[model samples]
Target: MAESATALAIMGMALVTYLTRVGGLFLAGRLPTGRRWRAALTAMPGVILVSLVAPLVLGAGVAEAMGAMVVLALARRVALPVVVVAGIVVVAVGRAWLTG
Candidate 1:
């Protein structure tokens, strides 16, 4: 009974949120909003990426994580592969340091 009630509540919340998003799109047609709003919406992903990456790059409040982030930035020429290698190195070193 409790589980069913919780599931119902969750579904209700999701339905409401979906409706809100659809409503926003519907209302956008009526609004006199400009290109700036569209541009800002388009930049949302970049904004989110920076927000997510910035803290991780600066520090994980851990030295290994910090070092890996710096090296990742330095290896911009081979960004994807360098990031993968840096991540592996940071994890290996961090694990070793923590365990030993």
Candidate 2:
């Protein structure tokens, strides 16, 4: 009985969390976040991209990550696809070199 009760409690908490995340999708259309919020939302992608990539470049503290960043910087003046390929190549080489 105690085990079942604990399981039920955990299940309930998981359900609540799932609902909260999904609920936002439904409720978002109704919310009037206004012009400022809309403008901020437009900028969110770049913000999120930086948020994700910045940590990888700075916090990863690995040779591959540093090499990738350098390649990425060079690619900026050249082309985006070039930068992406450079990153992949750098990572693959670094991993193989470091591991083997």
lDDT of each: 0.76, 0.80
lDDT of 1 by residue, 5-94 (tens): 999999999999999989977886786568988888779789989898778656654656656665767677667767777777776787
Q: What's the count of clashing pairs in each model shown?
A: 0, 0
**Candidate 2, position 61, lDDT:** 52
Q: Candidate 2 clashing pairs?
A: none
Model 1 segments more than 4 A misplaced? 16-42, 64-71, 79-82, 98-100
Candidate 2 TM-score, true structure as reference: 0.52
For model 2, what is the C-alpha lDDT against the true structure? 0.80
Clashes of 2: 0
Residues 23-81, model 2: lDDT tens digits: 97898678778999898878988999999877777777576575766686887487877
